[model samples]
Target: MADVLSILIGLMFTCTGCLLLFGSSISADVDDQLTQDFKRFITVMPLREMFPWRITSMNYRTMAGVLQLSSALLLLLTSGVLSTIANMVLMVVMGVAMYSHWAVGDEINKLVPALICFSLLMIRLFLHLRHMPKDKKD
Candidate 1:
């Protein structure tokens, strides 16, 4: 049961990661609509717009997807020791990033999917790293 749930959770992350990347890629076409919808919540222009906003929904979603996809691929395809170890460090960074998104009061509920995806990626990363050496040795 636990293994099945774990796999399902992982699959969920992969699907959402795809959605996030897809959304970011098409954000330019939907920028106006997205901006208009949340102008009150948005502090500045969307990612599609070339502005100096510190953060944008599209930007966050895009990078989050990139990291999540990379993490997943690393977990699924990694066959060596070093790549697995690197995935561990990335997992920690991604975990902090997931928390940072909500720590600043950006509506945790809105980021639930991304949050779950991050968690799943972290789990995969951990599994890959758990048995690997901590450092490279010749």
Candidate 2:
């Protein structure tokens, strides 16, 4: 059950990452929508305020896409420590996404996806840790 859930999560991330990474290449409508969405996301992200230099929305989106893609690949292709690390990374990403939605004063509906993903990641991590060998737990 855990393995099946992990695969489903991995596929979800893969699709999300691909959409983000190739958003502009897909279609004009998608590109424009992504552009606007990222612009709004950048405005809400704390890192934008913390950084000294100007950071474009596309930069944030690209970085997120890369991270998600890499982590999803690790989660799909590996097990044990590697998969654990990937799941943690995804959790962090989803947490940040939820925070961004809250910061922007988005409605609950907008935050639901991130919240769901975060919950799933937590559950998967718990299951993974529970099944891990006691010796390698440290």
Candidate 3:
């Protein structure tokens, strides 16, 4: 059940990243929509202010989206060491995201998604660690 839930969460993140990266409507309209959506949440103010630069420059957002999608793909296709590494990498990306949000004074509500992803990835990593065999010498 936990694994299934994890996979689903990964899929959701993957799909959202894909949309942020390659969706057709990613021009001004989408940007505007994103702003409008964020405007509804006070916690999202910092992100809202950062949205235009973040989305328009197509640098940071694009790279993060690609990484996120790649991580999700790795988990879906191969659920072993490589997948674990990818998840760890994504955790770093999300950690940076959380930091940026905090630095900009975004509210806790705005930080929840990144926090959730980061937490879940950490949990997955720990699960892997817990299952590892102990090293021993004869």
lDDT of each: 0.53, 0.90, 0.70
Which residue pairs show collisions in model 1?
Answer: none
lDDT of 1 by residue, 1-112 (tens): 3234335544554664576577546666554554343333334323335655566656665665676566555444545654455355445545555555455466777567
Candidate 3 error regions (>4 Å):
23-30, 33-56
> For every model shown, what is its TM-score relative to the native structure?
0.46, 0.91, 0.72
* Residue range 29-136, candidate 3, lDDT tens digits: 876654443334334333547555533334555666788898888877776677778878888878877876776676899789989888888887887677767889
Preferred candidate (lDDT higher): 1 or 2: 2
User: Which candidate number would show the highest TM-score if scored against the true structure?
Assistant: 2
Per-residue lDDT tens digits for candidate 2, residues 49-91, read 7888788898999988998999999999999889999999999
To one decimal, what is the Cα RMSD in angstroms of model 1 from the true structure?
A: 6.8
TM-score, cand. 2 vs. native? 0.91
Q: Assess the local accuracy of residue 3 in candidate 1 as a C-alpha lDDT between 0 and 100.
A: 37
The predicted structure with the larger lDDT, 2 or 3, is: 2
Which lDDT value does model 3 have at 102?
A: 79
Worst 10 contiguous positions by lDDT, candidate 3 = 37-46
